[model samples]
Target: MAACGLDFGTSNTTLGRWQDGAPRLLRLEGGHVTIPSAIFFAPGREAVIGRAAMSAYVEGVPGRLMRSLKSVLGSSLLEETTPVGRERVRFRDVIGRYLAGVKARAEAEAGKSFDTVVHGRPVHFIDDDPEGDRKAEDALRGIAESIGFRHVSFQYEPIAAALDYEQGIAREELALIADIGGGTSDFSIVRLSPERHSRADRAGDILANDGVRIGGTDFDRMLSLGTVMPLLGLGSPMRRGDLAVPNAYFHDLATWSSINRLYNSKTLREIEETRRDASRPELLGRLHAVVEGERGHSLAMEVEGAKIATSERGGARLDLGWIEGGLAAEIDRDGLVRHTGDLARRIAERIGRCLGQAGVGADAIDALFLTGGSTGLPHVRAALTTCLPQARVAEGDTFGSVGTGLTLEAARRAA
Candidate 1:
């Protein structure tokens, strides 16, 4: 029996364990330490998770593909059910099934079962709602216990990243840890030192923790609305008086967690009704094709890919030929900034709140530590760095730092 650390991120997951005097991320999928947070249920077969889940859906396998399962916590949707083959599965159960699979993989790789664990959680699961935040953590703890972990504890995600960063530092410093993932952006200001790494309690060192629900998914949604939704009649006029196509359908389509809600018959009927009155029936026809074909997830995936491409290469072309012949959109770095700039501002503002909570000036910070997949976005990085011009920037494993730090926590607790 061993204690493991789990990072159930919105975009990806990783499990780590303390070994050989350090925290080591265990391989979860065929030598890959990190796996996409995805699951697919193909008719009568068992659910497949991680990369295989994404691959199965992309390859056109007949199934329900669920991504961003972590986003359901603390929401009414968690108790709601979605059709999974011949069964209606609650979102909570879906999350449990996914975590169970992840646990099984980690155990198999480590050749041992884990009955105790440390889980990483965002600073605020639902920003500004204390009850919702508490509910989310309780729900996650319940899920972890239900999955056979007899003892489970949680660490704030950005704080966990700070712990990992502390392991390599030689001196004490006031550091701001930024963990921007698929579903949320979390920040923490802490006094970290190699000397403090082995301390059993770190309450005094942690100054402030703050976060927002905005993250990579929000960026994807904004980018989609800016670049792709127009072709689907997002802002086009309708035949009716003074009406444009309602933005609700386009928004749901652009959001990863809400995409599936647009795939049912009721939504289809709504699209049809709207299409009948749309001035540009051709655009509505494209929307109809997307809904009727249940291609919302596919479209979101394309948008996400393009966002990544734009971040890395400064631009990317979105091919929507599958939705309609010759349908495509071009998005460049400038356009991405134009659409997602507000989100970046909100994130930066949250950092200011964090600084205030810590009672420290920006220049007083010695270092800025960044982890999480979304931190790779150029504009997002610039926003954080710009806020602290004098602080030196430090980077952690974008997808694994939190889990690795959780492993260290687990080891400490076990000891």
Candidate 2:
């Protein structure tokens, strides 16, 4: 069987296929170069992704389509989404559809059918669990099968990133990979040896990784709480009491930071209550969509739709102009910094604690491999740099790291 690679993450899912003696990213059929990990049910029995579902959401008919179901994987909620016309489907059912869509896209892109794949997940996914390795293996294999792959194996997300970082470690040395992503922050400590790296492709045993379930997405939430909330009057109204409806609305608004859109029937009530107060579901959905999976755009996107001008523009208006007498205050970029500061400190501290636990010192580590959507943040980058001043940090666009590394790994295995 030919091989493919997958990076199924909290914010997005990326694919890598074995082709022409190397791995290539699978280009989706839609105009978009990357397929959104998002899904929504529509009126015609068709599921929407990318721009289509997003557009419909803004138009106020989100249907049964959903996004960010990965976080609720083990919960009973995964098996029970809202009742759509008496048809009940679980979140995994949506995920199963996503896997199938990914497989179809891979087949189209490679122009051939591949039966096997190598996939990556975070290390804490394996490290924190008493059944870490086993859980990782089961989740990876189950996803592959659900998506139509016959055989598959799993590698750690950080480990894959490490392999991508140094495919050939000419010397034996300890290296740390700090992956701060939309879902969680994780790390890996490996004794990279040329001998081991060369042999890792065959047996997949040359990696040792430690991970934590905290990451940059949390920072986004913190910012939304501080700066974004103030703009929406969430801070004061929350303290005024009897603000459950709007408070819940603001709370849901903050949730957009992490990409957790698979809401319960209760969400309908939240919308209804807000509508009674003259809030538009479409506008609310638009705000949610902006912050959903674009972890790289967290702070900037909070000011989208006329509030913020550019990702680096710093200050922009929050466009509360439509809120029918809402405040017309000016929000600037410094607010983002203020909102994101504590989050940055927390991540830095977490990185330090993880390093200390492994008995590894900053000086002894050779390099810091960075990955995930949030890693693109200047603050996060600086945090890693500050925390590991002695180590070299990898540089690249945040979205390309894990899946791109998986592509590199597939070729290494094939060769």
Candidate 3:
């Protein structure tokens, strides 16, 4: 079997295998194309993914839902101590399900079980939270072993992404890969060989790497607060910042798997009473024809949806109709630019610094390879254009490049 490549990312996951001298991306189960980095838990302790999960969530049964499990890979969740459902599910257990899902998709596509898989790991994934990261990596390795894989390996995400772009690059050409992903914004500098055409012949070593735990996800959180929160005045004069207020919103958002964790009987009760006590005028007088109690939560959800869409779609509309009784200010593309611009600039600046430190000038970066779903934002593109004026910024398939490269690395080492 050709080596399987897995770019297991924070916001999206992708799988590819080599066939007929090219990498073939496996299509996911849903008609949907992207390998989304999200999962949802249903009432029966069953898991839904991609479209089905996203749909169940629109119906509003929150709690025990998990999304973006990749970021929490190295966490207490690994121990499975945090109990989900009647059974205990460790961080790896959840991850195993996700991996298994992807594996199944690939298995179906290839008409056979994949016996070898290579994983993409962040350089700091282990050191970031030493004990936990170790456990997380072990957990991932364990998954491959359990599936009867005979060989498995890991490659640094940025380096792997860099190799993906270096192939077919000319000799002595320089390249930089800015893997602005969901949980992190990281860049890698490398010098390339003219003969580079495959991961095996890439003939290069990593120059330098720098990363910050910031990416598109952070921007989403910021918009939730600076833009989406006050609409309901989650914090009144007395409760401002207390009871977690908007911070609670993020706490809820941090995990996309189970939305059920966010509310309890008491919290739900509070929401009910708060809805009555809130004067329509307090929200926006009669100017807003909608935005009642449930609408508030719905509105919050809609904003998140719009933001995700805007990331991919470039611009999305936030329809106030979702808000039932009262409405707050509208969120437009400009609002997104306002809240996320600083972050975009910071990421670009970091990339520039990494290039400088490696003694590779921006002009020498024959191409700036980009990965991660967050790189789709216009401002991020603008920042790169301004900072790397002389280089070609190649946009790799946001979801699959890392995994395919990692898989190629594994295959080369084994060969």
Candidate 4:
């Protein structure tokens, strides 16, 4: 039985296979191992995935662009439909189609079909909602089986990352895996070594697992609201004097998962109404331009870029040319901290709880392994380090670790 590991992340996806006594990730898109978890339904054409989708949307192709598809899981919206082209498409089907594409590409790359797979999932799909979390997993499992996977199993994303890191270490160590992805931050404390690799059962090796719903997308939203949304009358006073411009519209625009909500006729009419009642009509007009132009995704992309850029430089420039010509915003590191500080603190507290659950002191941990795209942010690193100052920090393939680890697990299970 041939098996593979699939990391169906909110921001990106990767498929991996066990080969040559090691885990190997397949090239899913034009020799790229990672595919942007995005889809575009262009007019009169087939849906496209990854970079092609982003390009089509950015090129002004007439159709619907969907990103952050994973965020819909465990939410009521997962059962709903959205307008795409001339038809309404179910969100679950959208996810199924995307996963099917990944499966096809993986089979082509591996020269074989994979019936069994170990899929990576967050520790908690929905925070403080057990029913929703269960539904999310069930939904994912249903999607996987529907797409021809006969033997489907699950692995925590952070645990998968830990497994990948364990492969490179020669000695046993108490390791903490911090996986900060686009939609969640998950933590796992595990005992790992070369000796543990041969064991088929790792239930006893895992000490504790914890996670929070906060992630990169949340940071992007915070940054967007703090800097860009205000420019479009998010907090400006309405003509009624006592009331401020409605924030729901700006919040949806700032959030990748909710951006599509701003494209409807009702939302447009509401925006017009708000514009009429807005004391700063110019700002509301800018907001109208954004929603009317269907540029919410483009704007979110710009904000995401600025967030990533702020990690390296003192500040980053966001070009909002779609909103208005010569319109832009600058975001600094301090601003990033100000907007996301509470999130970082919460993440740090979660790490503390993980440690507490494992019955281990922070000093007892041997290493802190950081993976996932969001872990690259300096503020996130600082937050984690604050929790475990004595432990050495090691960075894994931010995007590939979980998939690679899943492949390793798949091979173990198949054997």
Candidate 5:
């Protein structure tokens, strides 16, 4: 039986295998190694995953589109069910189905069944909630078991990236691995050397691990609240004259994992009632149109696009013609800095905690290994580098490093 490595991320998923002593990530969808962690349950058609799912949703398909499935793991919503077409599906089953899709694809590509697999997960599924964290991993483990994997194991996403980075090093070095994914930002301090690459026992190599439950989706939420939510009456005054339009609806709309909740009849009715009491009825009218059209995810994608664009340019403009005619908003880099400053600081603080836990100084680190898609953002990269100014920054395959590294681990464990 062949064993493969799976990096099941919040935003994307990748599977890799060891081929002739080299780790190679399998192309899961149309020559792309990384598949968007998205699913669409069409009303009268088969469910779609990855790029096709995103495309189908954007093309106005009638269905429930779900992204950021991993974010629900440690939350109360994990135990709840939501309407996904004609049926109500448990959040756990939704995740299991997604993982099952990944497993089936890998088997088809490899032309063999995989009984043993290694999966990568964040260091902390839920910060400061030990029971929630344990339950989250247990939930994932159960999902893997149900998906036909007889033997399953787990690896920290950041450590997996570190192992992949370590394979190319010429000499021993103390490296900091910063992995900022869609749902979490994790850090690991490890001692790596080419000489140690062949060793099966790497427990001594890893010094410390630290993480916070914040990542790209959180950034998207902040950006949405700061820029897009206002246009939807998020801060508009109600007829009560003293109270503002309820923020919960806008918050749910901005959150990837909770956006689907806004589609229910109760939420829509509440929005309508709020609109009647809203001082700015026109803005709430636009909000009603969005909720009625089930376009929360579309709005979120627009904000995410703006966030990505700001990384390269000074600013980006969002076209919201779906909500209102000729409506646009400009999001600047400085605004991103202001909206995400607290998150960046929290990430930096986690790095400090990792260094302290490892009993290492910032100057003692030889290199900083950056991986995960979220690290591509300028603000995220700056946050970690600013804390460890002495270490040379090295970026691995931003999206594929963890999957490749997990492939190495799977090969070792199988041997």
Candidate 6:
């Protein structure tokens, strides 16, 4: 039976197999190795995944767009039902169907069926909750097995990145691996060398592994809440009482996982009731329009795009005219720093805990290997590199490293 490695990440997914004596990622989406972790279901019809899903939603197709799928792993939302078009489906099945589609694409690309798989997982699915973490892993394992894998295993994401990094190293070195992705920021301190590359047992090489549930999506949420949500009457005062509008609806609307939760009739009625007392009914009306029209994901995509633009060019203009004519916002490097400073610090703090767990000083690390899409953020990268100034920075194939590394693990297990 064939084996492969699956990195079903929060923002993107990649599947890889050991081929021609090296780990190679399968082209799952039209010659692309990485596919956005998204799916769209249109009423009673079949579902489309990856970029097609995003495009269908953008093209005004009537469907439910589900993104940031990994965030539901440890949360109650995993088993909870959400409206997918005209039908209600559990998040678990939605995830399973997405994985199944990805597996089929990989098998078709490689011309081989895979039965055993190694999956990449964050060190902690939910921070500081051991039982929740275990439950999340168990749920993922069940999902993988349910999809068709006869045997399943998991490797910590950062460690998998480390393994991928180890392949090019010539001599022994203590390296720190930072995997800052869509849903979690995971870290690892590992000893890597050419000699260890062929070793089947790598338990002793991984000195420490730690993670926090903060990532690119969290950054996007913070940006949306701070900059975009207020325009939707998030903190506007009410006409009846001294209290401002309750923040729950806006919070859910800003968050990717919970956005769908606000589309129900109960939420619409509650929003209508809230609008009656709202001092600015026009803003509440916009909120009503967003939820009623299911435009939350579109707004989120705008925020994410702005975040990327701001990171790349130091400034970005958010055109929200589609929601309300002439409505817009601007975000720059300074605003990103102001809004996401706390999250960046928390990510840096994880690195400290990782070092302490390894019982090594920061200066002892020879290389700082960075992977995952979030690490491209300037401030987040600064926060980590500043903490380990002596270490040389090495960038991995941000979205592919973990899957490639996991394929190595799968190969080892098969052998």
State every prediction's TM-score relative to the real structure.
Answer: 0.99, 0.77, 0.80, 0.99, 0.99, 0.99
Write one digit per residue (lDDT tens) for candidate 1, span 75-146. 899989998877798999999999999999999988899999999999989978999999999999999999
lDDT of 4: 0.93
RMSD values for the candidates in order, in angstroms, are 0.9, 5.6, 4.7, 0.9, 0.9, 0.8
Residue 346, candidate 6: alpha-carbon lDDT: 97
Model 1, runs deviating above 4 Å = none
> For model 1, how big is the CA root-mean-square deviation?
0.9
Report, for every candidate in turn, its global Cα lDDT versus the true structure: 0.92, 0.59, 0.65, 0.93, 0.91, 0.94
State the displacement of the C-alpha of residue 53, model 1, in Å, after optimal TM-score superposition.
0.6
Worst 10 residues of 4 by lDDT: 314-323
lDDT of 2 by residue, 236-302 (tens): 4222344532555455455532233324445545544454453334444433333332221232234
Query: What is the Cα-based lDDT of residue 169 in candidate 3?
Result: 60
Weakest lDDT window of 10 consecutive positions for candidate 6: 81-90
- Ranked by TM-score, the better of candidates 3 and 4 is 4
List candidate 4 segments past 4 Å from native: none
Query: Which residue pairs does candidate 5 place in steric collision?
Result: none
Error (Å) of candidate 2 at residue 19 is 2.2
Clashing pairs in 6: none
- CA displacement after TM-score superposition, residue 32 of candidate 3 (Å): 5.7
Q: Judge candidate 3 against the unseen true structure and give its global Cα lDDT, from 0 to 1.
A: 0.65
Question: Candidate 2: where are CA atoms >4 Å away?
Answer: 29-33, 59-65, 74-76, 83-86, 126-140, 167-174, 193-196, 201-208, 230-249, 257-311, 325-333, 408-415
* Ten-residue region with minimum lDDT total, candidate 2: 291-300
Clashes of each: 0, 11, 30, 0, 0, 0
Give the residue spans of candidate 3 off by over 4 A.
30-33, 44-46, 59-64, 80-88, 126-135, 147-150, 168-171, 198-204, 239-246, 249-260, 269-301, 308-316, 326-329
What's the distance in Å from true for residue 296, model 3? 10
Residue 178 error, candidate 1, Å: 0.5
Superior by TM-score: candidate 1 or candidate 2 = 1
